[model samples]
Target: MRCQNLVCGLVLLLALGTSTVVQATKPEDTAATRAQGQVLFERTCLFCHGATGQGDGPAGWFLGRYASPRPRNFTAGSFKFRSTPSGDLPTDQDLFRTITKGIPGYMPSFASLSEAARWQIVAYVKSFYPGFRTETPVPLPLVGAPTPQLAESLDRGRALYTSFECHTCHGTEGRGDGPVTQAGELKDASGLQIQAADLTRPSSFKNGASLPDLVRTLLTGLDGTPMPSYAARLSDRETDAWDLAQYLRALSAESVP
Candidate 1:
C-alpha cells in the first residue's frame, strides 16, 4: 500500500511541477541588497504597496474597492498567505513564495524577476515592520505526499464535502454563489464584505491552487477572512483533511498553472 501510494503521489507531483519554485538557501541580508530591493519595490511594487508599503497606492484605491482585500496594510503586518500559524509573521520563504506565485486575481506574479531580486524585495517588504528583525518565524511542517488511496480518498472527500457543509459557502458547483453569499452575510476581519472562493477556477486561487497548497490551506485556514480553521474538527484525523483536499481538487475545471 505504501509503495502504491508513493507511486501515485510521485505522478501527481510531477504533473504539478514546481508551482512554488524551491530555493533551499536564503541569501545574505545586506544594505546593498536591500537597496536594490528598494529600487525594485519602487518600480514594480509601489503601485500596490504604496510609497511606504501602506497598501494605499492610487491604483490600489480603485482595485481593492471596498471589499475585504483593499490592498494589504503592510504596516498592520497582516497577510492572507503564509505557512506560519495564524497571527504570526510569515517566514522569509513564505514571502518569497507569495512574490513568486502572487495572489490569483489580486497580486501579479514576479516570477520574471531573478530569484535574488525577489529575495531582495522580500527583504524590503519585511522592512515595513520591526518584527521581521526581532523575530524568526517558522513555517508549519507540511504533510507527506498524496495517500496511496487517492481514488478512495477522493470518494470519501466527495462525501465529506457535503457532510461538512462546505456547499453552504462554496455552493454545490464550487461556484462562489452560495447561500451565505446570497444572504450578504460573509464578512472579513475588517467587517468588509467578502465572498467565498470559486473553487472551479483553481488557476485563480488567491493563496495557492496546487493540491498540497489546498491541504495546507485546509489545515491552517486563511487569517482575517471569512474562512474558518477546520483544524479543530479536521485535525484529529489527517485522512479527513486529505480527502477534503482531493475533493476540492476534483471540483476545479482548470488546473493550477
Candidate 2:
C-alpha cells in the first residue's frame, strides 16, 4: 500500500500541467485505467457529456439557448478551453486542467477528486475525440510577465481598447452592454443570443480572470463565442496582453468592492 500510494503521487506530479518541470509519462490508457475513467465519467460527467460523450445528456437539453452555456460535444473536437491554438485539439494537460478548474458559473470545480481520478476523467473525455491520439498539442508562449499595474500600462491598455474597437462589443466602459448586445447581434456558435462579459467582475470570467488568464484568453479567445483571438494583432507586441490584462483588472475592481 505504501508503494502503491507513492506511485500514484509520482504519477500525479509528473502529469500536473502546473508543474514547472516537464511532464513525464502520462497514465497509460490501459484497460484498468480506462475502466476507472469510464466509471468516473458516468458518475461525474454523464449528466453533461452523456453515455457516449456527445454533450447530449439528459441535463444537456436545457442549456441550449441565449446567455446559457451549453455542454460541449466532445466527439466534435472543437474545444474552446485549449492552451493550443484555435482549431487544434487540446492537449491532455489542457483537458486535465479544465477538469480540475472547471468553468465558472457553469461547471463546478472537480478538485474534490483525487489527482489520479481527475486524470482518469481527462482520459475519459479524450476518448471521445480521436484527434487526441494523433495530434501533439503545443501551448503558446506566455507573453511577457504580467504587465505591471502602472499608469502607463493601463493607459496603453485603454488606448488599445478604442483603437481595436473593443468598445464595439465591450462598450466604452467595459460593460457587456455594447452596441452589438444592444442590437442583439451577438450569438454563440450555436446561434444563441450572447452578451460580452461584463469586465467589471473578474470572478465571473469564464476562462479565468488572473492577469495571465486574461492574457491567454485574449490571445486564444473562447472558440465557441464571439470573443476573438487577438494573437495576430498583438504579435511581437510583448506588452500588449499584459497591459490589457491590467486594464481589465481595473475594470473588475469597479464591481468587486
Candidate 3:
C-alpha cells in the first residue's frame, strides 16, 4: 500500500510538470489572451475600425468625401505599409509598428497604449483575416550598402531612373508632379484617387525615410498604392536599388522652397 501511494504521487508530479512546461512554451492568443485582446479592441478601436473592423465605423463615414484616404478595411487583408513583398501580408511586427506609429496625416498614433495592449490589439486585428492563420510571411531580402562613391552612384541612379521611366510618376525633379500626376491617373487598389508621394519631402514619407527604409520600399513597394516593387526588375549590374535610394536621399536634401 505504501509503494502504490508513492508511485501515484510521482506520476501526478510529472503530469503537473508537463502541463506547466506546455503552458510556458505556448505562444500568446489562447482563449484567455484573445479574450483580453477583444476587450481592448472594443474599448479603443471600435470608433475608427468598426465593431467588425471593416473600416465602416460611424466616425469614419463622418470624415467626409474629402478624406484623401479612407480608413483601412482589415477584413480585406491588404496592407499598404509593409517590409514584405508586394501582395504579401505584413508581419506581426509590421502591424505592431504601424499601430504604434500610425499614419501621420490619416491615422492617429496609438503609442499611449501599453506595449502588451498594443500586441494584443495586433493579435485581435489579425484575427479578422483567415490568411493570418494559414499563411507565413516572407521577408524581403536586404541588399548590400550603397557604393562609397556618392557622385558615381548618383549618376548611375539618374541614368537608371530615366531608363526605368521613374520620371513618369515621380517627376524628373522628384516633386510628385510627374506626367501621371498631371494627368490625374494615380489610384489605389480600392480605386480611390491617390497622389504620388512628393519624394522631395522625406519627412512626409509614410514608410520611414531612413536609407534602409527607402531601400526596403524600393524592394517591397507600398502594396495598395501606385508604387511597384523593383525587386524582380533590377539587374545585378544595372542600377542597384541602393544607388537609387541614395539619389532619392539627395533629392530630399534639395531646398523645397
TM-scores of all candidate predictions against the true structure = 0.87, 0.86, 0.81
lDDT, candidates in the order shown: 0.78, 0.77, 0.74
Can you give the lDDT of residue 241 in candidate 3? 77
Clash count of each predicted structure: 1, 0, 0
By lDDT, the best candidate is: 1
Order the candidates by TM-score, highest first.
Answer: 1, 2, 3
lDDT of 2 by residue, 50-146 (tens): 8989888888767654454678889988888866777778777777767877887788888788878888787788878888788788986654455
Candidate 1 ranges beyond 4 A from true positions? 1-17, 148-151
**What would you estimate as the lDDT of candidate 1?**
0.78
| Tens digit of per-residue lDDT, candidate 3, span 1-257 | 56765665465445433421121122386666667788998888888779898887767765435434667788999888777888999987778777876775667778788777787888888888989999988877554544443799988878878887889998999988899988988887777767787889977777766666667788888887889888886647423876887788888774411
TM-score attained by model 3? 0.81
After superposing candidate 2 on the true structure, give the runs of residues whose Cα lies further than 4 Å from its correct spot: 1-26, 64-67, 254-257
